[model samples]
Target: MSKPDKTSRHGERRRFSPSMLRRGMNLYPPFLGMGLRVKEFSDDWTVCRVELKLTRFNRNQQGTAFGGSIGAMSDAFHALLLMHQLGTDYHVWDKAAEIEYVSPGIGTVYGRFEVSPEMAEAIRAEAAGGDKVLPWFETELTRADGTVVARVRRQLYVRKKKSVTERERADFTG
Candidate 1:
């Protein structure tokens, strides 16, 4: 028996590729039970597309996609993207989230989450000095024909870890 390597080929902690992330998410119970599938993840980790299909298991009693399923589909992507982008040196968490039910979802509904380069850069810069930064991201769940069924907003808290030297410097400056 051999121990599994936790580091990537580059000697850094193994970073989850889009495919890997999708596969792992599919196995998660909440998503699995709801038929939420990760349809796509961009190579750069900037974009993620998720879809939920209406079925007996996931449909509401009124015969539409369940609100809980829609909300679950909206969760996690923003934080996941930021965590990978920021790497091991930073802490990223989903501080808050809100979802608005705009209309009933029918058939297959899609949700896409994207973080622009500018937004990523802004988060990095804001957290570089060891201060917490809150960044908000929004996405919509839509039907196959592009009718929005819901809107979701997520706010993330991010902060860079301070090294001993940086901590000492801050202490002296204070």
Candidate 2:
């Protein structure tokens, strides 16, 4: 599979560098309000680590992490990673999500997301035919000590852009 052109589904060039994305995510209203901070975002957009600190703003009545906040930790990342990897020719979006609370999140918890080259290749192959593909991914929210706090499952919708498909058809027929 070829590397993506770093354009959005709207065909605009992606302007944010990895650091910029990390900073932007940290300041993003919902994340900021929920005490979520992106600790690491790799230059290749393949690996991202986010930390959720238990604070008054995101604490439940039981004094643990808010369920909404925990769910938020899994939002947008899989789609973002796959979009960047698949480039302008494809559209990627979060189609569905589910979070299973394993334990009360106390103190600080972390969520890590990774998109391997093999995974990207598989997705590209699956979406090459211009049909939408829904792929599921899973990650864990863990405590500082690596105890599981929650399990998050995300499904992303990916499809080749119609323009790309049309252009390819023209190339073949013309």
Candidate 3:
């Protein structure tokens, strides 16, 4: 269950119930691929706890996980969080993403994104008007050794697609 957005500055401290996100897999692909478990997320931040599945890895010559897989895990967190917090009636896509290697990525990888209420507000403001892309967000990927494997910045497009009310997002109390 997601908590109500206490700080209204992030547009409106709205909570996109986790159960709702779970039922909407058709809306996201990476979430399906990443198979992430959202530990926690508010309007401003998110923490996703995921294990690096061997099946999803490309063993390098040295047996370390593939850099692309590492990057993908990190990048996917931001997209998942955005959808969970912001609700539907908008479109989101990875505008751009970048990753920096820090370790050998020897073990399970975890991804986290701090969205900040201020940033969320900004995204709402930008998308509230139209379908223009919001500014990019930076998230981090960490290895089991507590080393930063990659830092990713993803640009997103959020727009009010056809005046979505509470029901469209299934937020209606009735």
Candidate number of the best lDDT? 2
Model 2 RMSD vs true structure: 5.7
> Which residue pairs in candidate 2 collide?
none
- Better lDDT candidate (1, 3): 1
Q: For candidate 2, what is the TM-score?
A: 0.86
- Candidate 3 lDDT over 15-34, as tens digits, reads 54444443454246654454
**For candidate 2, lDDT tens digit of each residue in 8-54?**
43456787767778998888898888999998877677888999999
TM-score to true structure, per model: 0.85, 0.86, 0.64
Per-residue alpha-carbon lDDT of candidate 1 for residues 64-112, written as tens digits (9 for 90 to 100): 9989889989788898877766677888988998999998989999999
Candidate 1 — worst ten consecutive residues by lDDT sum? 3-12
Candidate 1's C-alpha runs over 4 A off are 1-13, 164-174
**Deviating ranges (above 4 Å) for candidate 3:** 1-45, 53-57, 164-174
User: 88, model 1: CA deviation in Å?
Assistant: 1.0
CA RMSD per model (angstroms): 4.9, 5.7, 7.7
